[model samples]
Target: MTVIVRDFRPEDADAVSRVRRAALPFEVTTPRSVLFHVESANPAGKYRLLIAEMDGEIVGTAQVGVAYESGTPGQSYANPQVHPGRRGQGAGGLLLRTAEEHLAAEGAVEVYAWVLDEPEFRAFAERRGYRPTRSAHFQRLDLAGGTLPELPARLPPGVELRTAADYTADPRPMFQADAEVTSDEPSDIGAELDDYEDWLAHTWNNPLLDLGLSTVVLVDGEVAAFTAAHTDGERRYWSGMTGTLRAHRGHGLAKLAKTDSLRRARAAGCTDAFTSNDAENGPMLAINKWFGYEVCATEVRHVRTFG
Candidate 1:
């Protein structure tokens, strides 16, 4: 079968979403969310969404872009997803090749991707000259019936809990906290959230993010910790990013924020909760475990260089 890889069209929203959902059932994906990503992406990121079609039928999709906000330059990312029913075809490779060429042309020095932990997926990445780096697991919580931890009776002194909506007038403080914690996150490609405008265009404007369910822990007026939440407008809730500032790491602020967020999410009709954690992040992993989340799937970070 001839697989043709090309730029995504506005009409490809449903097809792109279908492929993503079929390839990775654990994550929530919607047509509007996909369109929002493409339209709202920062131009500095040089973001491109591509699709692979076989006989005029979409079979695979990839999201490619530079880490424009990274403190460091030349870092890029490309994540490809092939439809489950269409897997043995050449769509995956074609989509990946197109993504790499696009990124390389855009001055990317290294391309990072996530490969499923399964042997076949790992071998495919290795065959493509990609080296494994860190791994992260997708965790799931049965919010419908399973028991959740009771909210703590009291928080530490100088600590108060709030939601992302509370920062509506100004989110720079939350952005600052995110920048600090993200810089310390374990990964092969380093990121720097130095561009406030880009962050606002992308992160802050993302459609799936539910600021009301996102919990923030404020320490004496400073954003100490937070758990950003995202939902698919249905039953699933996602912990988009959860982090604690360096100075406030030991005070259980991360837990406090996440706990508050999860409680609110459940109360708002979210049935299932999901989050991803780097396998080597013992502290965060322990925190998620304390909340009764279990690993449902794992993916390894893979990197490949051009030239």
Candidate 2:
């Protein structure tokens, strides 16, 4: 069977989403989100969504892009996935080669990809000249059936909990908090969140973002911590981000934000909750563990530098 890789078309949304969800079940993805991601991608990212077809059926997908927001130049990423049932047909390799060619042509000096921590997955990447680097975990919690700690009888004096909806009139505080916390997040490519308009468009306006379920913590009218939430408008909810400002760390505020967000998600009929974090982030990992989140899968970041 001949497998061919090509640019994603508007009609490929459903197929692309299907392949992505089948391959990475822990992440939240839908046809709408797929389209939005492609359309709203920052111009400088040079994002390309590729689809692999075999005998007229899409069996694999890849997202290739320059890390324009990264402080370092020439850093790019290519994440490819093939449907489990279609893995042996050479679609993944073809997609990878196509994505790499596109990235290299776009001036990428190095490419980073996340490969499943499974032996075969690691071997595949290694054979392709990628080397293992840092690792991250996809954690899940049974929001509907599992036990969740009761909310503190009373939040610490001067601390208050609010939803993202509360800032409908003005989201500057939330943006400020996100910028502060995100700047400190552990990432191979540093994210420079200096553009408020970009944040408002790509983040605040995203369709999957569940404003009502996202919890924000405030200390005396100032944003301290927040847990951004995303849902498929059904049983699945995802913690888009959970962080506390540097000045507010160690007060258990991050935990508080996540806990409140998860509870609100459960109340909204979400049956499962998902989140991920860098393996080295002990504080967040411990907080997730406290909420009974178990590691569902692990992905190791792999990098290949072009000579």
lDDT of 1 by residue, 26-100 (tens): 888889999999998778889999999999999999999998767678999999999988987888888899999
Give all candidates' CA lDDT scores: 0.89, 0.92
- True lDDT of residue 305, candidate 2: 94
User: What residue pairs are clashing in model 1?
Assistant: 70-192, 71-192
lDDT (tens digit, per residue) of candidate 2 on 1-307: 9999999999999999899999999999989999999999988889999999999999999999999878899999999999999997899889889999988999999999999999988998999999999999999999989998888999888999999999979988888988888888888878888888899989999999999999999999899999999998889999899999888889989888888888888888999999999999888999999999999999999999987
TM-score for each of the candidates: 0.96, 0.98
RMSD to true structure for each model, in Å? 1.3, 0.9
Error of 1 at 240 (Å): 0.8
Please estimate how well model 1 matches the true structure, expressed as its whole-model Cα lDDT: 0.89
Q: List candidate 1 stretches off by more than 4 Å.
A: none
Q: Report residue 36 deviation for candidate 2 (angstroms).
A: 0.3
Residue 67, candidate 2: Cα error in Å is: 0.5
